[model samples]
Target: MKDNASLLRRKDAATPRGVGVMAPFFVSRAENAELWDVEGRRFIDFAGGIAVLNTGHRHPKVVAAVKAQLDAFTHSAYQVVPYEGYVALAERLNRLTPGAFPKKTTFFSTGAEAIENAVKIARAATGRSGVIAFSGAFHGRTMMGMALTGKVVPYKTGFGPFPPEVYHVPFPTALHGVSVEDTLKALQLLFKADIEPKRVAAILIEPVQGEGGFYVAPPELMRALRRLCDEHGILLIADEIQTGFARTGKWFAMDHHEVAPDLMTTAKSLAGGFPLSAVTGRAEVMDAPAPGGLGGTYAGNPMSIAAAHAVLDVIEEEGLVQRANQLGERMRGRLEALKTRVPQMAEVRGLGAMLAVEFCAPGGHTPDPDFTRAVQARALERGLMLLTCGVYANVLRFLFPLTIPEPVFAEGLSLLESALTG
Candidate 1:
């Protein structure tokens, strides 16, 4: 309706241009795997708010909990006044996240804050200043987070002179011709050329590279990092912001590996649709930050805690982890078959529901971002939403809500097939 168009126009006028938004479709409502625009035209939510709605939009349990919390009270920063929901959420994270060591969790308002605090704690605990990030990683928009992020365009452009002692190394990706050995070599080089390992506070990595592409960190690679960290006293930090909850068929994407990181960062899906990020880690490391060192005005705000507690409960009771696996297998199989039809289709890979279909030229050697753009345009016209990624911008990541029905998923796949052929 004209109302949707008008709202979008108003949004453009009011919001900062730095925030890049696509297709100004105003959402009237979103439920499960679909979103209805203000005009009531329904579109499948394959983007799922960029993997934030792992349990799907407004899941009954999550909604009920938020409403219940509203009836009582909203804000009371945990520091000022303790809340049961905050403690409950932390307890859940401590129990669910990987690692047998005693763990503690602290909440924040966004993934970036969680990451920043995680790094702070790591440095405070180890008394070091160096951190190693990876190529193609997207940490966040904040200065320190951007310094840690590898992507240079939109994210890091014009905002140079980032935090000191931050270095970038290669991340393993077979399709991109990057190997685990290459990654390890880059890390070794980083130590020798950039900073000594003993002086490095932490090495932060996404279990599955999120904004870069859905490149899963190899189990061998993670184990090697664990070994290296143990040898050098560097804390291993796993950023599960986009792959936590049921998105990866596990509580945390790091759970896929046998090795456990010293610290894990999570957000996005943590508080259902609300904002809540956290840093969960070994008790000793987490306690590195002195009593008042790790928090914000909104950190562990009462309302976010209520939502997070409900999210954990919903994930546990619904068997969403298994559901994510089934969804991944089904979607990835279809994508694999499409490789034959589209010789440009490079690779189909992922773990659980977090999957991606990358495209390259006919030789399957060079990324085809142009073709990827065309595919996305066609799909959007057909009422199917999609998001792209990759350092080369040639990846089409599919993050359909794990709770989507079988028929809806199949229908989206059919439409996607049509888009590719067109």
Candidate 2:
């Protein structure tokens, strides 16, 4: 009834201006890592809906789950009338997340909701009010999440007086010349100058920072945080919203570290393509929320839970974790080789399929956000979709679907390289 541009204009007037849309290409449908816009144009989706399509769009198992669920039931929220799929999904998450101790999981509708509830549980359990967040972490878009996030341009700009008692400390980045010990010192200083150790409720961080950058947190840093939490009685939270599922070549990114966290937040690929988020953690910490204290009207919709169950099945049945490793390795290797041709490409780093190529001015570390934007635009024009992030906005992240055909992945990478070089 209406053209894409006209429809988008109507939507813009109705919806708030707070949302930042990527190209105006309204996707009609997608399968695996490929998307077809309403105009009937095909584009290789390197963005993957900002890493939410790890299983790829409309994966067969995930699609089947949704279809089957549509025939049975869609709602009757878990809080109102609990269902089997919800409990089963929670049990699976508990077993899957990294931790030896008993764990419990609760679901939500989004990553921000999961993160918010996790903080509430930690605060209630520890009887503390302060939370320590890292400088480059992207928690979510909620008020509390915005407070926890480390960026300022779009995510945190004009968003002030965020949730209280949230303090920030530097996050070590090798490319930025910050060390793990330096981060530790900043935390120590924060405790002494701003928030006291006794008042701290949690220290939440992204295992692999998303939105901010595709920076993988080092194992040493993870282990150090675990130790610090142990000594300070503060709960350590691993926000694996982006790195969860099979994106990081592991079921959970924390699996890369020797230590475990008191709480973990997951979303994005949890329910295949459905919207679902969860907080799984130590049994005791989870129990902090009283029976009536936690839960919402649409907290764990049966349809979404069913889809999550199917997502897990697909991940295992397809061996997507291993697939992620293979795919990520291939992508990174190609980008590394291209570095010689594109002198502006400063570093290529990431874990598994959550890889990124950071760019800078040629021969210098001066971030080249303009070049990054140009490359992304060029890629889009050439029928490849890409996304950018980082505090300086100079990193191009690749989140191709694990189900993407090898040839298709190669084709997208080649186009991307040409864009960078051109």
lDDT of the candidates, in the order given: 0.89, 0.89
Candidate 1 TM-score versus the reference: 0.98
When summed lDDT is taken over every stretch of 10 residues in candidate 1, the lowest stretch is 1-10
Clash pairs, candidate 1, are none
lDDT of 2: 0.89
Off by over 4 Å in 2: 1-3
